[model samples]
Target chain A: MRRALILSLALIPALLSFAIAYLFQRGAIADFVWSGTYQIDAAGLFSRAGLAGSALIAFILLTFWWAEGRAEDTFQAERNMQEETRRRFFRRLDHELKNPLTIIKLGIANMRHTPEISSQQQASLDRIGQQAGRLQKLVEDMRWLSELEAPRLEQAPVSLAEILADAVALARAAYPDRAIDLAVQQAPWPLADISGDRDMLVVVFRNLLDNALKYSTPGDKVAVRAADDGQWAAVEVADTGIGIPDADQPSVFEELYRGSNVQAIAGSGLGLALAWRIIKLHKGSIRLRSRQGQGTVVTVRLKLPAPRD
Target chain B: MSKPTLLVVDDEADLLAELKPLLERSGFAVATAPDGRRALDSLQHLTPDLIILDVLMPHMDGRELLRRLRKAGNWTPVILLTQVGTPAERAMSLQEGADDYLNKPFDPIELIARIEAVLRRTRRGDAPLSSFRRLRSGQLSIDRQTRQAKLDDDAFSLTARAFAVLEHLMLNPGEIVTRQRLLDEVWGWEHAVETRAVDIRISEIRKALSAYQPGCIETIVGTGYRFIHEVVGHA
Candidate 1:
């Protein structure tokens, strides 16, 4: 739409120049043929000038079309290359972080066994162990996101119910006080598993659950419901909390994009982006319908693969 | 009886100085080694009833020394002493023939208890388990119930916990009783306490045996305590 608008605007100046020149040439021809009397030659010259002007305008329009198409192609190519480079950098970073993390785990284990340490010291050490575990999880998230760009989406029959259950369990453990009302319309939901990376699926649910917990006011219900859409599994995580505004909705899934209303909330702003990538990888679509003061409902439809041979 | 001997091996001079006198006061004939090589050298000439081995050291670490000692068939009960032993590291050590482990900056009382228990365990027997009603393994004699123990026909002096510990080993004979099981059976604790507590008691039992029974208890690494059902002469 923007391209068409620019092309029309550019052609307007050319159209005006042709219209003025055609009028001037016609006035000049009026004197040559007969200033006081009309002649057939004057009319002929006027028609020829009009024909010439239309031919020139058509040629200019064709040139503008070619230039606009080339520019768009170049812009798109640059955007894709930039995305690829960013992914490669993150993947390498994740792999590098994991090596030291493994070593730290082994070293900490060795330290914990030394019986000479006091109990107080041991408790402090355990806390450090938990933090390291969290770091390991973050690195895992990075690796999963980088994998999304690969062409062949690795799909396998995954238990949709089990994944939801696990996510609910984690949320409960994280926020035992929160009243999270989970309603499954189809209790065990066709036992129909969607085909996607189980790890990625777990991450998706976790991200949504995390957001739900954060945005949810105390005593508000965060509902999780799933339905088998025959060809796809549609899961919705609806939170009755502060929601995203209309203008910022389109940019929510953009890398590191945080909604203007929720910028003050603590988050890396990467969760939704990563979730979108996983959804995209499964050849699925995720839609968000949120009202600023009302609530937010994130609906994700994951394309399930055919049954195994 | 003479003082039960303890060989504390660590490269740190300050730690050795502070710990040695404390151990001596606790009724242990304390011996010190600055490094693993020196500790082994000292071992060649004299075998202390208990060895408190440091896990980290220059030239030879506590683990490597324990490995070398086991390879040479030296089954002297060792209490692994270090501040950095993880639970897994301690498990690996126990598996690798380390009789027990204690983290560093250790309490003197706990160290004394561990030493006594390990010593008592080592003096049970050097040979595999066999039924012997009036079993005599060198200075030690087992009079099964009446739960009586004697050293060369003299009544063996042992703490009640020490006696119970010794009895458990004698009954099991060659079998290994894990630290957890020992705590349950002997300490009467329904739940497992720190494995180190068992190590401490074992040290105490070993100390008593060193004075009364000599070499009777044998440590089966990584598994549990066992009685070396034979009278193996000292190195």
Candidate 2:
């Protein structure tokens, strides 16, 4: 509607100029056109009309430009406001879920300590505690996702090799049955260091390794390799597991998005999204390559500090 | 003999109620405080052997209370309790003088085990003479009397638990001290299935020593760390 209004207003100046020229030629300057009466110059009349028409068009164009700018400003402001509101909602939700989850966990712990409970009752309480622990993990992942969306990382000199080692050890501990290997093929004496938040980077690697281990079988091999190429330090986590489908690869980094192959698996689907956000925040990139039946490999690339001359 | 007393400070009334009875069952005279202020006030009259403090609390949190206690020259062992903590938070808490920490919704049995370990260390410290008094390896020297390490003339401070681990390693130089042995000896945790706590402290100690002397503590793959015996002189 506004576009139509602006278009009509733009045409009004040209229309008025044409109408005035027509009236001047027909009524007021009839003799001037036909017999050149009263020494009226025809070229002068056309030039004056042209100048007036240009002025009117310039005024209309300036007004339209200003209005369009205002509309864009309103749009950007609304978008930012909506984003802030969504972020706030997630923060509040995380806090609310965390407190109650803590309470439930404590309650379960208290019940388990009671010696009077039967074995059957104890088993049921164990299940409850396990489920609550899962809920707590989900809540933590959600909170971490929100934090990644708007990161406030306390960056410092962190050893990539150490972080990878810690993550690999943790994954090995968590999934003792799986065959996980860490190959630091080309790490220099102390390994290359990147300026990043150690804890956050650890979380990123842990999430990746956890996903790789979760989707794989007992005999499947998961390999993590780290190397530096002067400008960038890179780590690749590869697994012989169920790979993501071709159609689902693009949307895997989306929040809460699960693949069709992962229906039976229990997951929050926030792992890759969190990893992507964290890597981006550190001025790095993560890439994924996989075949349907083969396996998946995730490579995270981070910039290394320039070597001293 | 009187049982050792423990002060449990948490904002959760239900948790406090539940924990008090459990600790009493484990044979400790337990004192309860809802916040840091009350805990500090209780310290004036009651001298507990150890303090189990919740990190997040109303009106002065555990970290602040610990700083205050350390600032006031109270060297009572403190074990921090939290819902979930990052490595950085754990490191920060250790740096602030907490003897150890446990995650929330922890098994009661585990808490008791940690408490016993910390209490044992505190008791040992109170005794006058121990077998290992002072150790010298190269320029590095550790004095068990003052619980301090000096490299040449510069002194480097370590957390109580880290110091104990270093002392154990220094005493048995060149021996590959297994993670389990360190956990049992330094942490006093007998049935510790998770040895990651030991790994973290070892990592911290390695970081502290990396600047002055690198590779002093050698990590033996699949076993443990061996503190190299590079004795130059005894201070």
Candidate 3:
């Protein structure tokens, strides 16, 4: 419908020229007796008018192009501004909501500790505490997402052994019931030292291990191994559990994305997202290999720091 | 067990009302303050075992209150209740003197745990010997007998509170000490107060320690302060 309007507008100049040319042609074609009074050349007049009409068409097209370009820029800028404003708004909203929730959490906790609160109320409070824990994790995930855009990766001489130990400690704390088998070669590998944030790397490993434990069946073994491939260091987390389906592997790293097998799991779908972000920040790559029934292996490769001259 | 004493400071009446009965029933002797000024006024006579302090308040925010408290030799364990906007400040509060810091809208259960932890540290004792015994890292000397800090032969003069913080850090060495722990141990801040009281005192400790030895204390940006220098074994 709008295209028709533009086409009609473009034809106006041509139609006006045609009408004037028809009048000039009528006089020009008159007999010799009327030649002196009607000296107009129809073709010449129409040609001259056509040139002006062409120029008008060109001007119209140029104006259209310029307006469309400006409109696109304005639209994009407006969209960007809207997104930034939305992010800020959500961040503030998260903060505002956190306070009252905290007070409630504190109140519930205090109530639970009291001998006066009934056993049933304590149970209810326990549920509230669990939900609050979930809420806190959600808030943390949001904060992590915001930071992931340009997450700071501090580089310092870090002991890989120390980091792995910490990750193991965290895993033990996270799943005290789960049995984890860890095998280290008789001699500790003199791994290459890399300048990266140890805490972020810890999160990455912890998440990987946590995912392994979450997906694994009882009595299944979760194994962690590390090796140096000369140029990069490779750390693999392998678990004998319900593996990720082939179809869901691609989108696993996407933010807030969870696998089809994750429906029954208790998670915010942020573990891998955070892990991906942390690895990327450290200029590393993470890959997953899994089959529907077979176990899954997640391997992360990070560049080894260059030796100082 | 006697009810633990907790000082709840905030300008919001509704919040105070909500907190009072909740804490009272939980076996706490609760005191209330509407603002930082009133909080300090209350502090003069009532030394709460733990303080639940708001970061943003009228007539002296939590930070200023902590600064004044440290300057006047009032060391208390404080758990800072902070809003999201003040995260950087919240992190800094640990350095100031907060034993532990929790963001606002926190889970009351977690807050209680933090409060109890600080209270446990306080009950352990206020003496440097007890504080020093809780931490271990390098060969750093904190002479509680003379209230002197020495890095080998270098003499460092620290305020009583500053010395307390140093002692606390020396004990932990490489471990993270939240601002709340410092406030609870050094300043005797009873409740979890704002994190800034920690920031100011840490800055003071840093200045004094660095005067004797460069880069003696390392500021762990989002966590509490730690003494970074490796303690060399005495010959």
Candidate 4:
């Protein structure tokens, strides 16, 4: 529609100039015929001029069409090449790291069984194992992100409230001793379910809730609030933890980006990025609002399932 | 009885070196193969109780070997090892007749647990049934097609709610299934059911289950119910 409008707008000047030229040519031709210098018919001259104008206009349009098609072709090719490169890179990373990491982990497990190792050596071994686990998690995160770039969602009717509850349950099970006061509320009880991949939706909320719990210390307050409009559902995951700095807030949803203020916290830094990717895949919007020392609230807005869809 | 022998196939010599002693110490006679071709050659002359197949290899990959094994009527229990195991991969591995699967760089502890669970299951005069359409633990089994819970030779009729609650519990064996989770899962979230309602269905299932196996599902006081058995899944 925009292109058509632009095309019409572009023709206005051409049409005006052609009209002016045609009128001028008609006047000249009439004078020539009256003086009998050229002996040209006015109607014949007008028809010839109109044909030439049409040919010129068609040539210009053809040039524009060719240029647009070439631009799109290169753009598409570049995008596809980039995506293939990413997929190959992740595959190599996964395969290369698996066997050695396995060896390190299994070797650590075996070493601990020996009675000769001192307590200090055991601690170091444990640390090595933890770092290996973190690396494995990072690799998994990268793989999932790459997969998300393609359309891999098993879309279905999924309940946001139920998923929120499940995520809270998982978070609670994972960290039973975080000592954070947690609250969850759903406006008007149960919200209408949205169409999405159940597993992915669960992961998105689970990561959001997990991050909320992970960034907070003991006695911190974390809450989840969700509401349903007529055709959309909005949820807010808020926490009274050390909020992200203004400089880092914008990039928190980028892959592997960690806040400078969160240097002490242990994280893969892909949780929010994963959540952002998922919400975007579901045709939704996610936003983070925070102040330096106060708190952060992440709001997610998603569309409800269409009536006949 | 002699120790069970395991065939561990991978292209990484260093991993095989590290893994062999671990499995040996865990009471298995471990045999190593550098790739799928060697593993298949060994299988022609040797019968290992379990085959640990790696996903990536030089001569052939584990998935192809697995497909060939099943096509040729090799019924030995197989556990797959892979890198960055996704949900789809996990599901596919099980469907391809693998007894179990573990993501690479895993704790040796989980590996052992999976091994034992798989062994115990196959030892129970049962076929490798990770491709489960039915759920079972010992003498009690639930057929999903008929929605019937059978105990030994007797069939106990259960309400749909009870069967769903039981199915969920069986699916997540040894994990706590909270009252709220059961309600949300079984009651469809739209029904405003109390946590007390979960108790009623659990009692009905508990009475029927106790006839064959006592204390099948335990109530964890304040938290939830945990299915107290090594649940085996089958077709």
Top candidate when judged by lDDT against the true structure = 4
Question: For model 1, what is the alpha-carbon lDDT of residue B3?
Answer: 87
Q: Which window of ten consecutive residues has the lowest lDDT sum in model 3 chain B? A: B127-136
Candidate 1 ranges beyond 4 A from true positions: A1-76, A99-103, A110-120, A148-153, A157-166, A183-195, A228-233, A245-251, A254-268, A304-309, B1-235
Candidate 1: C-alpha lDDT: 0.68
Predicted structure 1, TM vs. truth: 0.40
Off by over 4 Å in 4: A1-88, A148-206, A209-225, A238-250, A260-265, A290-295, A306-309, B67-74, B91-97, B120-125, B131-235
**Model 4 agreement with the true structure over B1-235: per-residue lDDT tens digits:** 8999999999989888888989999999999999988899999888998999998899899999999999999889998996655546766887798887777766687677667767776786676554678988999998866878888768898766678789878866776777755754564221123465578678879888776765889999986898989788776
Query: What ordering of candidates by TM-score runs from best to worst?
Result: 4, 3, 2, 1
Q: What would the per-residue lDDT of candidate 1 be over residues B1-235, giving only the tens digit for each residue?
A: 8888888888767567666766676678989998899899999898788788888789998889999998999977888874432334544766677776764333345566667666665676432222233555667865644556677778865545456677667645555667655654454321212354466557767776776544567666775787767432221
- The CA lDDT at A16 in model 1 is 60
List the candidate numbers ranked by DockQ, top first. Answer: 4, 3, 2, 1
Q: State which candidate, 2 or 4, has the greater TM-score.
A: 4
The lDDT per prediction is 0.68, 0.74, 0.68, 0.76
- Candidate 3 — which residues are off by over 4 angstroms? A1-90, A113-116, A145-154, A165-190, A219-221, B1-14, B22-53, B56-80, B85-87, B91-102, B105-150, B153-235
- Give i-RMS (Å) per prediction: 17.6, 7.7, 8.7, 9.6
TM-score of each: 0.40, 0.53, 0.54, 0.63
Over 4 Å off, model 2: A1-113, A132-206, A216-230, A233-251, A254-257, A289-297, A304-309, B4-9, B31-110, B113-150, B154-235
Of the true interface contacts, each candidate retains a share of 0.00, 0.12, 0.35, 0.56
Candidate 4 TM-score versus the reference: 0.63
lDDT of 3 by residue, A146-195 (tens): 54443334466665656666677778876998877664333556766666
Candidate 1 chain A — worst ten consecutive residues by lDDT sum? Answer: A31-40
Docking class of 3: incorrect
Better of 1 and 3 by DockQ: 3
